[model samples]
Target chain A: MSANKSILVCRCAERGLVDTDGIAGGESVLVIPDLCRAVADGDPMLGGAFSEVHACHPRAVQSLFRFAGHPLPDTTQVIDCRCDGAGHAALGTMEDKPPAWYPVIDYDRCSSCGQCLEFCLFGVYEKAPDGRIRVVNPDQCKNNCPACARICPEAAIIFPKSVEVPINGAEIDDEAAVRANIRVNVDEILGDDVYAALRARKQKRKALLNRKKIERALEERRKCSGGDQ
Target chain B: MKMEKTGVHGIPSTLQERDSLRLRVETYADQQGLVPPLSMEELRDHALELAPSSVSVDYVMVLLNNAVWRETVASIPYERRLLLLPQCLRDFKNCPAEMDEFGLLCEECGRCNIGELQSLAEDLGYVVLVAEGSTVVTRLLDGGKVDAVIGVSCLNALEKSFPHMADGAIPGLAIPLNAGGCIDTTTDVEHVRNAIRLRSDASWVNQVDTARIREMVEGWFSAIEIDSMDTRTEQIAYEWVCGEGKRWRPYLLACTYDALSGADGIFPEKVRRLALAVECFHKASLIHDDIEDDDEVRYNAPTLHCQYGIPVALNAGDFLVGEGYRLIASVPSRTADLMRIAVENHRMLCVGQGEELRGLVDTPPFTAAQLIEIFRRKTAPAFGAALRLGALAAGGDDRLDAALRRFSESLGIAYQIHDDLEEYRSGEEHDLRASILLALANDQRPLEWYAPDSPNLDHVFREMMVEEKAAQLLEHYKNEAIRALNPLASAPLKSLLRRTTSKMLTPAGGRA
Candidate 1:
């Protein structure tokens, strides 16, 4: 059976209904496994009662999080339905956090293979209609995964594995914390300047540092040779 | 009369020994105040500076001494085995003197001791003499008197012998305790036994196998009748593609498939061809990748682009890719259909490449959905295609194909996610792509819309370490892969498939 059909059947079975193909208590009914079990036990009334429950919530289905038994953490606002009799989780609300995603890229080594765009199942990539294979739209991503990075032969893709917001009393930019430090620095330093003078300055600084390093290495070599004599 | 040492290339085992002898000859070149006979500029320069002051009597003696020790230590059977004069042996070498007698005394008591050793040496056509230091040993070995050696030494002999003996193949056993640390008294009966064992145990043959995939290709070339008129062209074409490679990807394919099929079980030739075809595809990509990446070396050898020049290398890569298509197409009809899926994977690969390039140019917040979609298309398809090919090659049922496809895709995604995490974890300096993760996690909108984080916030950093976000995603995908594998009838294939999938979701323990 198709995955959707399986879900439908599972729902029918869980309601303990006699899945008869007809209107039952003002609801459409169909044959289901639990209904058969109830009928076999000669509990026609129980089966009928099952059909009634199905009628009341015909579209009721468990969320992916609920199905996986990893419902989102509770906060002050949203009610937590999976709590016990104890006062601990007895009253809880679903936490409000921004939708999270990780992107995997290796800027130093990326040789720009457009495999991620072609492979993506969602409309997650907007390859330039001009034939550039770049992802113009990542808002349509699924499951917050960064799969583009792994298949990159030169490892030019980056993705986040985890994102945690420090729950301490101090305020923190949880979003900035999730981004890479270098990227954060670059954004801060370069700040919307696509062609910043900072680029030349940084290159100059690197060149100066490299010269100093070379001079130091040469001096070291001279010392070793002199010491040998 | 003196015999001059002649170094020849043809008969000697290694170039090193001949060079050493040549160095000894040139060590005293400075005394002549003339340019050294050596033609090579570097060697000539070295000889001028390093040559000794003179090639006098003492120097010649030292040279002979060095030769003897080298012979004993190196154990190469040479012609000039003995440098000692007959007079040196004639005087006090073989005969033993009594304590009271001034003249030599030889009482043959048949005790089978050093006296016997000396007499037996003459009978056996070997040399028996009391020598002082390595000078004598070197002279003997260099003189070609012995192909192997047995040295019995006191502390002095042991120390003297150890410098060369430590690295030599021949065995030399030590017998301790002798007055004045002489070699004669320390020589023991057991030393003979050790020498016999050493000779029997050691093999002097060179053990090096130069066989490689390139060699196999060469052999095939030789077997095939390439028209002599086209021979040069064929050689060029063949060398262009094969180049110098260990063919590591092909090796991995062969090994992994063998492992998947339960070790050493042969698959049909068609399947084998498919496996090889995949490897060829991987290599062809690498060849092209090297050019695009501007890399100089691959596997410690010059990259194809570097060696053959970029344009030719590019053509060679294209040619190999063309060959890959031919190879895959040669497989059975159904397998060919599955292999065609590889074309889709190739498309995904290209898309991924473009995404990466674009990401560097533009900085914006990406949603989780967008990133996952990229992963599915880019990373998952290639890996998924590989697994599907393997399944199809095995003639797996529909259930098996569906199961493997789902398992491979999920596993591929998890593997990609783990890889992304690793890139950043390696440190910011190591990977430039860490920006992607940062953008995804922080930028929830277009670049202009997002507000920068204030410096005072440490709590924000803590939120970035939430392992559950990735762990949950990983577990969900891994569960799907496992669930897919459960229905397979072949326990072994199921186990193999499951194992391959599990490897993707494994916890990070080791660093690359």
Candidate 2:
């Protein structure tokens, strides 16, 4: 996309929105700082400059545009610039993803003590309209804070293992190395029994994943064959 | 012929049936006010009285005996409690493990859960014996080395051991193995662990009624209650403060005080005021923060500023700040010390808040470390103030104050990171200035991910990379907070703080 067609506004003044100096059409990419305030102040010239405005919160930016009294261009696209600098560069290629981790309540074990609901400062767990306590906002849960689980008398709450994403070009080997280190640490601290159990659990998980992969492949093949028929 | 349902040794087969039997036995024991050392006949009589005529009298008797002794067994110190595991629990076929005079020495091969159970029980200071038969247990009790026994045995073995336990007057908890095979049997490890870890000392956790404390704090804000304390400004401040909140700040203060000074006695009046002071500071900060952030709502209600306008809200916030200082000054003991600590924390909080406001003027792509640093500045001091004031109210020294500062800093940073993750998941408007997720993605992901024409930035938020990194940091800080308690001499305080750390961070089914 031509730089003139896109405006990159950095709400953060500390770092320039992007290192625009290196790009071919980088100069045309307007790097406006404190864009929220600028838009809130009804900067008339701001809206006429670009067809598309890229900023951290697109919804907020759109509101600002409306407040500024500038009619949005027909081709206007308010790109959400909430992601980090690296994410901004690769936004289009990214796919919809599941939550990295969340709490899963074992109904059988839960006594409906409501301790979790009371304990969580964040509105993560809530009383449902039906009056049952539920994980109403799984996303609001602090991925690592299992405070509610610890306080739970019946030990009903469980969280999924956090997803590990490869950083930079770190291959699967790097991930394996990290896991190996963790295993060694666990063995040293919790003894070989825990280590063995963890290894067995991991192996089981791998087997399940492999089976799912095979099933998906078979399903795809069947679909193709059915289409031909 | 119809097969009769039975457990390992003719107990109830299903868990529900077993639990029902145990509950009945316990109710009978409770009604009788029975303690341990009841004669076999006495236990049998009580069990028979509670049990239905169709139910086995022997099974009910054993259940009643176990129930009566549980509390006494729990009251015994770990050093005096013996963990007796049946040798049959081992994977005897695969076992290369050796045995001494005491019993089997687990090789920790992990074929069965024996090794894990042994290691954990030993770590908790229990003299774990991986042997069977009642003779050894009775001999240990006769020697007076063991006051209580948490025994894992088959139903037959548990029955055999009961007469010996009753003879010795030893408080014991019996966990009947799931099956009766002599070579290898299974028992619930969690049940055993819970038995071993049980202590009457930790009953203080249940004693502190958080609901009651919250009610008392809420009472402090009532118009009639504050009528004598102050008139005009106090009433206005109470109007804003009386709004619904989790009241975590005051709760933390009260918990800390109760931890330091046992909850058995009356709560100190000065500590109560100090807790109220912490809330005042918290409420004041919220009012100012709302106006600064231009937030319209708080606690599902209109913010102080939005309700009464900025000028009135600002005055009310200022009044709260003054009231906080007044409350601290009113503390009967260590008035100067309390004042100094409060001022220091207040200034630190302001500096942190100022930096945050400054950052908004020119938003930066902050790194995770930078975001954490901001968190420490903004959040840590508030927690520190509450903790230190509680300590100070309880006649704590400088050493305790120093430790609390470190603990609060780690806790505060972790807490803020937790909030960030929460906000990210809620799909709320991103506050880019101090977002660890944004910082992490910027640092870790490739530059292409931030392209102007990138279709969806949603992937960045969903990427496990940032969340995982933040989780690791959260764990690190949580451990740091726990570690800070090492210098603490009071076991109860240390334990309470440790539990608090767990309550804050432990996810359901997460590691203990």
Give per-residue CA lDDT, model 2, range B107-177, as digits (tens): 66688888788778767776666763443444454322345678887666565666656544556788877
Worst 10 residues of 1 chain B by lDDT: B80-89
Reference-based TM-score of each model: 0.34, 0.45
Q: Among these predicted structures, which one has the highest lDDT?
A: 2
Local accuracy of candidate 2 as per-residue lDDT tens digits, A103-157: 5555545677676675454567887767666766655654334445544555455
**Candidate 1 on B136-157: residue-level lDDT in tens?**
3332332112334444433333
Per-residue alpha-carbon lDDT of candidate 1 for residues A116-159, written as tens digits (9 for 90 to 100): 55434344554565554444443344332333332333333432
What would the DockQ be for model 2?
A: 0.01
Which whole-number lDDT from 0 to 100 does residue B334 have in model 2? 83
